[model samples]
Each structure stands twice: as C-alpha cells, then as structure tokens.
Target: MPEQYLKKILTSRVYDVARETALVRAPSLSRRTGHTVWLKREDEQDVFSFKIRGAYNKMAQLDADTLARGVVAASAGNHAQGVAMAAQRLKCQATIFMPVTTPAIKVSAVRNRAARVRLVGDSFDETLAAAQVFCEKNAQ
Candidate 1:
C-alpha cells in the first residue's frame, strides 16, 4: 500500500463506532494446519461482522453536507448491516439495496438500525445496479 493511504488508515477514527475485537486462539484450525493460529473475533461486534469498521470509517470521513444528503449501499447481508449501523451512529439516512433473495433476518437487521431497505433483484449484480442507478438519479 502507498504511504499516504497507509497513514490515513492508521489515523482513522474507525474506533468511534467499531470495537477492537480480539484475536482468539483457534485450536481446531491450528490442529488442522499443524501450526498455531488465531481468529479475529469480529463476530463480537454489534453488527456481528468486521464489515462495520470499513463502513463506519468511510462514512465518518464524508463531508457533513454529503452525510446530510444521506448514503446508499448494496449488499446481501453483513455489509448492509454495517452501513445501517454506521448511518445510525452518524445520524444519516441510509438506503440499502438488497437482493430479493436475501434472508428476512438480514433485512430485518438493516431496518432495525433505522435504515430504509430496498428489495431489488435476485442477484448481487442486479441489486448493485439498482443502487448505482439510485445514486445517479439522486446525483449522489
């Protein structure tokens, strides 16, 4: 990675919304690989995914005007939850485009975070296209 970008990441305020999850010993994986191993306990997060770090960091860096205008995203599960969580923290509206086939649990999770949910197409690609079109139409 470039030095400038690395510095930005190092200085990120991602912790404002994201927890520093632990690295837990992974005995099973270690046994299989015949080496010591550890797994990041990202599932310990409120969103239950490490996806929240990136989502929160990206949103945190957005200009206030842009945040006021709201944010949009496309995802089938974790990423949607991450964005929704970040939106709630940042006090920004979020519209998440998800595939129609996405599980009800995940959809409910996004809504529970106060983000509007848009059930789009059957595949990730189609859902992404809908989100892109929405961004273009809204001039976001």
Candidate 2:
C-alpha cells in the first residue's frame, strides 16, 4: 500500500490544476520562536487551497467511463470549490452538495467553478447523504 501511495504521489496529475507552492521563511514567527520557520504557501494554488491538488489528481485518474458518468461530492468549504474546479478542468460534469448553512460566499465560489451546486441539508452528514443519493440516482 505504501508503494502504491508513493507511486501515486510520484505520478500525481495535480500539476494540471495546482502549482508547486513555495516554502518561505516566516520572519515574525521565526523571531518569536528564536528558530527558523518556513511556511508552505499552499494558498498560492488557483483555488487558494491545497485541496485542489488532491481533487484534480483523483479526477485525472478516473477511468473514462467514470468520467463520462461524471462526479458527485459533498462539501461546503474549500473542498467543494476544489472539486468544482477540478471537474471543470477535466471537462467532466460535477455535482457539489453543500450544506444549506454554508455561507453565501462559499456557495458562490463553488458555483463559479462551473459545477452544479446543490444546497442540501444543514449538516455535513446530511449533505453527504444527499450527495450519495444523487450519485445512486444518477448512476455516478
């Protein structure tokens, strides 16, 4: 399993949607701690989060049939935006199920990424259940 993970990491297709973030020194933190500190700028990604990489990589590796059937995900935060953007990049139809309580800004962000957004239940679990049902009904 470790070898498989290593291979996946080595060959990940995240670059299609994510850039190689830099490690930059944190001057203030370093000074406070009396030691060197570096921060990984994952926020440099197009989605402004590291989630895009994994989302894109997973979509990139999907079988043609699966891609054709499209994808469904349940998220109300960065992951929703990540999946939406990844699906757009892959030219695959995507459905994002977000909790009804999600902020309007976040919902708009996910919608702007070109995925079909569904405002479902108020909790993550309920939202996830809605997504699962959608997947089953749509044969995703």
Candidate 3:
C-alpha cells in the first residue's frame, strides 16, 4: 500500500464512532486451510455493522447546517442500521428508505436507533427511487 493512503487511513476520524478492534484468531479455519486466519469483530460495534465507519466518516465531514438538515438513505439492512446509529450519535434526524419487503426486525432496529423508517416500494430498486426523490426535493 502507498504510504500516503496508509497515513490517511490511520489518521481517519472514523475512530470517533468506530474503535480499533483487535482481530481474533480463527483457529479451526486456520488449521484447516493451513494458513493463519483472523476475523475482525466489526459485529462488536454499536451498530453491529462495519458500515458505520464509512457512514460516520462521511457524515462527520458535513457542515452543521447540512447535518441539521438531516440525512436520508436507502438500504434494507446493515447500511441502514449504520446510518441510523450514526445519526443518533450525531444528534441528527435520519430517514431510512427501505423496501416494504424488508423484515420487521430490520425496520425495528433502525427505528430503535431513532431514525425514521420509510417503507416504500416492493423491491429495493423502487425503494432507492423513493430515496432519490427525497434527495432531489431536499437538495441533499
């Protein structure tokens, strides 16, 4: 890897919401594969999703006005949860657009994090379209 990219990654502010988690050795997998194996415990994160790092990093870069205007995104699962968790931590409103086909548990999780869940469309593509409309209307 290039030194500059490595430096940027090491200096990233994603640490505010995501801590440095140690890799746990996958002993059985390592033995079977004849190679040392390790697994990152991103599940240990507050959102139980690795996507929180990227979500928080991007949102953290926004100006206060933008954040105050709120965030809107389209996702049925992990990304939705991450955005919801990040928004809650930042004290901003978040609207997650998900397909009506999404499971109740997933919807409940996002809502639990204080983000609004909008169940639109029967498929993910339609759900994304609905979120895009929100972005265009809100100038996001």
Among these predicted structures, which one has the highest lDDT? Answer: 1
Q: After superposition, how far is residue 110 of candidate 2 from its true place, in Å?
A: 1.3
Candidate 1 Cα outliers beyond 4 Å, as residue runs: 1-9
Ranking by TM-score: 1, 3, 2
Residue-level lDDT tens digits of model 2 in 1-140: 69998997878898667888999999999999999999999988878899998898889999988988889999978998899999898888888999999999999988888888999997999999999998888777
| Model 3 lDDT at residue 71 | 97
Q: Show how many residue pairs clash in every candidate, following the order shown.
A: 0, 0, 0
Clashing pairs in 3: none
Candidate 1 lDDT over residue span 13-132, tens digit each: 797988888999999999999999999999999999999999999999999999999999999999999999999999999999999999999999999999999999999999999999
Choose the strongest candidate by TM-score.
Answer: 1
Q: Model 3 Cα displacement at 2 (Å)?
A: 1.5
| Model 3 regions more than 4 Å off | none
Structural similarity to truth (TM-score) of each candidate: 0.93, 0.89, 0.92
- Give each model's whole-structure lDDT: 0.96, 0.89, 0.92
| lDDT tens readout by residue for model 3, 62-94 | 899999999999998899999998899899999
